[model samples]
Target: MSKILVTGGLGFIGSHTVVELQKEGFEVVIIDNLSNSSINVLDGITAITGKKPIFEKLDLREKSAVQEFFKTHNDVKGVIHFAASKAVGESVENPLLYYENNINTLVYVLQELNKLKEANFIFSSSCTVYGQADELPITENAPVKPAESPYGNTKQIGEEIIKDTCKVSAQLNAIALRYFNPVGSHESALIGELPIGVPQNLVPFITQTAIGLREQLSVFGDDYPTEDGTCIRDYIHVVDLAKAHVVALQRLLAHKNETNFEVFNLGTGTGSSVLEVIKSFERVSGETLNYKIAPRRAGDVIAAYAHTEKANKVLGWKSDLTLDDAMASAWKWEKHIREQ
Candidate 1:
C-alpha cells in the first residue's frame, strides 16, 4: 500500500478522509498541531477504521519541521493538505493569522515535495474561492472574484500557488477540490466535527443549541435575496466528501489526470437556505432548535452551490447523502459525545 500524508488528519474533513483512505488499504501518516482539533479524535478514528494512523503532533508553520517531516516520511506517495485556520468570521477579524497559517504552510510543504522524485498532491480548497459567483450553480471554470474574507482569499491564493508550482515542477501532480459546506458524521457516530471553541459552522451550531451546549443558534443573515431571506449553501455529507478525496487520489496515483494540475468541485448539486437547514434538523432530530435571525455577517456571500458535473464525470464520484441524513448523523454524534 502507498503511504499518504494527511495534514490536519485529526480535523473534521481530514479525519474522515483518513478513515476512507485507510479502509482502501492506504497507509496514512497524520500531522496535526492540535490547535483546532482534539487528541481524542485519534481514538475515534482508530475505533472507526480498526487502525490507528501514524500521528505526529507537529505544527506546519515551522518550515524546518515541515522539511524534517518530508525527510522522515520520504516514502509517502501522496499529500492531502488540509491544515489551516478555516473560520470565515475569524479570518475577517484576523487576516494575518490566516495568511501565516494557510499560506506559509502550503509553501513549505510544496518546497519539500518538489525535492521528491514524484509527488501526488490533493489540496483541500473551498468554494469560498468563488466568492459571490455570478451564476447560480458554480462550475469549476467560474471566475474567482474578489474574496469576501481573508479565509477565502487564502484558498484562492493556495490554488494559484499549486498551479504555478505544478507548471514548473514536472514531478508534481496536483488537484484542488473546491468543495462546499460539509456536514454530518460517520455512521458509527464517531470522529465528528469537534470544534475546539464555539462552533463556527452552521450544522455544529444547530446541534450544539439543540443539545443545550449553546443558548441559541444565530442565523447569520435573513435579508439575503433568497426564498427564506437567508444565506444559501450546498451541504454535502462529510462522508461523501471524504470518499471523493480517495477517488481523486486514485486518479493521480493511476496517472489518469489529463493535465498535471486539475480542479474539481465537490458538492451535491442543490442549495438550501439557513432556515431550510434548521427545518431539516428539526424533522430528523425531533428537536426544536432555538434560533433567531441576526444581521448579515461580513464576508458572507449571498449564496453558493455547485454544478458538480465535472466532479461527477471526471472523478466518477457524487454525493449520496441528503440533508436530512447529514443532520441526523450530526445530531446523533452530538448526543453521543454529550452522553460520554
Candidate 2:
C-alpha cells in the first residue's frame, strides 16, 4: 500500500478522510499543529479505523519544519493538504493570520512536493471561492467571484498557485476540491465536528444548543429571496466529503486526471434552507430548538447548491447521505461527547 500524508488529519473533515483512506488499504501519516483541533481526535480516528497513523505535531507555517517533514517522510506518495485556518469571521478580523496559515503553509507544502519524483496532492478548498454565485446550481465553470473575505481569498489564491505550479511541474498532479457545507460525524459516533470554541458552523451550533451547551441557535437571516427567506446552502455529510478526497487522490495516483491540475466541487446537488435544517434537526433529535431570526449577515449568498455532473460522471463520487441523516449522526455525536 502506498503511504499517504494527510495534513491537519486530526480536523473534522481530515479525520474522516484519514479513516476512508485507511479503509481503502492506504497507509496514512498525519500532521497537525493542533491549532483548531485536538489530540483527542487522533484517538477517535484510531478507534474507528483500528490503525494508528504516524502523527506529527508540526506547524506547516514554519518553512524549515515543513522541509524537514518531507525529507523524513520521503516515502509519502500522496499528500492531502488541509492544515489551513478556516474561519470566515476570524479571517476578516485578522487577514494576516489567514494569509500566513493558509497561503504560506500551502506554498511550503507544494515546494516540497515539487521536489518529489511524483507528487499526488489533494487540496482542501471551499465554496467560499465562488462567493455569491450569479446562477443557481454552481458548476466548475462558474466564474469565481471576488472573495468577500481573506479566508475566501486564500482559497482562490491557493487554487491559482496550484494551477500555475501544475502547468510547469509535470511531476506534480494536484486536485482542488471545492466543498460546500460539511456536517455530521462517523456512524460510530466516534469522530465528529468538535470545534474548540463556540461553533461557527450551523450543525455544531444546533447540536450544542440541543445539548444545552448553547442557549439558542440564531438563524443569520430570514429575508433572502428563497423558498424560505433564510439563506440556503448545500450541506454534505462529513463522511461523504471525506470519501471524495480518497477518490480524488486515487485519480491522481492512477494518472487518470486529464490535466495535472483539476478542480471539482464536492457537494450534494440539493439545497437546504436554515429553517429546513432546523425542522430536520427537530424531527430527528426530537428536541425543539430555540432559535431566532437575526439581521441578514454580511457576505451571505442567497442560495448555493451544486451541479454534480462533473463529480458524478468524472470522479464517480456522489453524496449518498441526506440532510436528516447528517442531523441524526450529529445529534448522536453531541450526546456522546457531552455524556463523557
Candidate 3:
C-alpha cells in the first residue's frame, strides 16, 4: 500500500480527512505538533475507523526537521498540507505568526516534495480568497480580491506558490480546495471542533453557549446587507470537505489531472445568513440561543458562497449536508465532550 502524509492530521478537518483516507485503503501517516489540537483525537479516530494511523508529533515549521522526515519516510507518495494557524482576528493581531505558520511551512513542505520522483499535494485553502465577490455564488475563476485578513492572505499566496511550483516541476501536481466554511463533525460523534480558549467560528460558539460554556453568542453584526442584516456564508459539513480532499488526492495520484495545478471551490452552493444559522440551531437543539448583535468586525465580508459547478463536474464532488444536520451533530458532540 502506498502511504500518504497528512500534516496536522489530528486537527479538526485534518482528522476527518485522515479517517476518510484510511477508509479508502490508503496507508496513512500523520504529522502534527499538537499545538492547537490534542493527542486524544487519535483515540476518537481509532474508535470510529477501527485502525490507528502512524503518527509523528513533528513541527513542520522547522525546515531541517521536515527534510529529515521525508528522508526517513521516502515512501510517502503524497502530501496533504493542513497544518497552520487559522483564525482571522488572531491573524490581524499577529500577522507575522500567520505568515510564518502558513507561508513558511508551505514552502518547506513543497521543497521536500520537489525532491521525490513524483508528488501529489493538496492545499487547505479558504473562500476568503474571493473576498466578497462582486458576483453571487463565487466561481473558481472569480478574481481573488485583496485578502481581508492576514490568514486569508496566506491562503491566496499559498495557492499562487503551488501554481508557480507546478508550472516549473513536471513531477509536481497540486490542487487547492477553497473551502467556504466547514462546520459539524463525523456522524459517530467521536471527533469535532474543539478550539482552545474562546472559539472564533460561529458553530462552535453557538454550541458552547448552548452547553453553558459561554454566557452568550455574539452575532458579530446585524447591519450587513442581507435578509436579516447579518453576514451570510456557505457552511459545508467538515466531513464533506474532508472527502473532497481525498477525491482531489486520488485525481492527482491517478494521473487524471488535466493540468499540473488546479483549483476548486468546495461548498454546498447554498448561502445561509448568520441569523438563519442560529434559527437552525434552535430548531435542531431545541434551545433558543442567547445572542446579541455587536458592531461588525473589521474583517468580515457580507456574503460568500460557492457556485460548485466546476467542483461537481471536474472533481465529481458536492456537499451533501444541511445546516440543520450540522447543528444537530455539533450539539451532539458538544454534549459528548462536556459529559466526559
Best by lDDT: 1
- Residue-by-residue lDDT tens digits, candidate 3, 224-325: 889999999999999999999999999999999999999999999999999999999999999989998898988788999899999999999888888899
* Model 3 lDDT at residue 268: 95
Off by over 4 Å in 1: none
Candidate 3: the clashing residue pairs are none
CA deviation > 4 Å runs, candidate 2: none
Alpha-carbon RMSD to native, per candidate: 0.9, 0.7, 0.8
Tell me the deviation in Å of residue 83 in model 2: 0.4
TM-score of each: 0.98, 0.99, 0.99
| Location of the lowest summed lDDT over 10 successive residues in candidate 3 | 292-301
The better-scoring model by lDDT among 1 and 2 is 1
After TM-score superposition, what is the CA distance of residue 295 in candidate 3 from its true location, in Å?
A: 1.2
Candidate 1 vs candidate 3, lDDT winner = 1
Candidate 3 segments exceeding 4 Å error: none
Candidate 2 C-alpha error for residue 198, in Å: 1.3
lDDT of 2 by residue, 138-241 (tens): 99999999999999999999999999999999899999999999999999999999787989899999999988999989999888898879999999999999
